[model samples]
Target: LFLGLIILIAVWKLSQTFTIMNLGKETSESLGISYSLLEKLALFLVALTTSVTMITVGALPFLGVIVPNLVRKRYGDNLSQTKLMVALVGANLVLACDILSRVLIRPYELSVSLLLGIIGSLVFILLLWRGGQKDAV
Candidate 1:
């Protein structure tokens, strides 16, 4: 929990910088942000969070990818604004998948990772399809 809190605080502190970083390297540098330093910091934070999560909860395949994409699609591209929503959605998604995995087969449970992988692939395909459609028009 301490580690999680630290990661959360770090993300909160850096969220605005991340938002600026998304605007392209030259733009962010022009805006006085150290692009490389912030990028390294972001990468470190991601590694830390991933390590902590993997150690604590084992693998949660696709949770990281799907949750943020879903949240971003609904909330737009502001990391600061969407981070909390992404966390909440990810938690709820895991909880829901866990419940479904347990209930789907009586006296036997599916792997949560398996469920998430399948769902994530479908959602990813749908997202790509939608993106392609938008580009076509």
Candidate 2:
């Protein structure tokens, strides 16, 4: 199961890297890569990862939406850079939240997963709201 999880994560990260590099089906196809194949591969990888995460960590609810976007916002769309930044930020966020939860609760640490879900969701909502409300002109 651990090996499966690792494979799924690798595939998921690679798929995301490819997608970031290519941007869209038309662009990817023009560049001679099979977008359909890549899309299917990505979906499969994501599904596997999600299933493992759900079963192992319970409902995550927001890491998927939150961490990657946080990275993209900070680093823009460079694939390698985005992946590196996301991994770093995600790790830092998890570590910080875990510490906060431990210290605040005192011998009753909230699950890191739960903290991430709440924090990520709230942050994502605020970002979306701000983006939507910003003037387009």
Candidate 3:
């Protein structure tokens, strides 16, 4: 649950970063948005969201990482655009994986996290391949 919560928060952060970056630091700063204030707002929101989600859903899968990446890739990485794209893609990915897992092990069930981990590994590999050079890990 904690892990899922973290990922949810991360997704929110990524979305915010992509949006805020385009707005430019200058504009944001000029608006009297202090770094500490923004940071606190973001942190509080993510935490509240994840905590509520965790209690209700026992942690949804693939929402944090997959949605944002899929959005960034398909749509322009603008704040509003990316957020929408990520939400849609994330939902689709989770649904598809859930279906696949059900079919793959008929009577048995698989954890969404486990399936996402496998998919995450593949995604990581693809990212590395597409990246011209590796950064310090």
Candidate 4:
């Protein structure tokens, strides 16, 4: 828990840097951001967080992939603004799936990964469909 908090704080602090980095390497560098260093830092943080999460709660499958995309689709591409919403939505999704898995079969519980996988696949398909429609238009 403490480690997670530390990582969350680190990520929160760097959110603006990340936003600048998203503007492309040359642009961010022109704006006084070290693109390579920030990229390495971001990758390191992601690796550490993923390692910790896996050790703590097993694998969450597509929660990472889907939550941010969903949040971005609704809230645009600003990392600092969307970060909290992503965390909240991801937590709520896992909590809801876990609760449903436990209650859906009475005595027998489904694996949270299984539930997330099914839901994630559907959401991914929907996102793809929406992307295709936008491209077509």
Q: Return the TM-score for each candidate structure.
A: 0.93, 0.79, 0.70, 0.94
Total clashing pairs for each candidate: 0, 0, 0, 0
Better of 1 and 2 by TM-score: 1
TM-score of 1: 0.93
Off by over 4 Å in 4: 135-137
User: Could you tell me the C-alpha RMSD of candidate 3 in Å?
Assistant: 5.6
lDDT of 4 at 117: 91
For candidate 4, report its TM-score: 0.94
* Total clashes in model 3, counting residue pairs 3 or more apart in sequence or in different chains: 0
In candidate 2, how many Å is residue 54 off? Answer: 2.8
lDDT of 3 by residue, 33-124 (tens): 56556667677767877787777666665467555655665575676556656667777877887887787888998887678768867776
Best by TM-score: 4
Q: Which segments of candidate 1 are over 4 A away from where they belong? A: 135-137
lDDT of 1 by residue, 1-137 (tens): 68988998989998989999999999999999999998999999999999999988989988898899889888999999998899899999999989999999958999998998888888878888887987421
The root-mean-square deviation over C-alpha atoms between each candidate and the true structure, in angstroms, is 2.0, 3.3, 5.6, 1.9
lDDT score of residue 122 within candidate 4:
90
Each candidate's lDDT (Cα)?
0.89, 0.72, 0.67, 0.92
Of 1 and 4, which scores higher on lDDT?
4
lDDT value, residue 71 of candidate 3: 61
lDDT of 4 by residue, 1-137 (tens): 68988998999999999999999999999999999999999999999999889989999888998899888878999999999899899999999999999999989999999999999889888888988988420
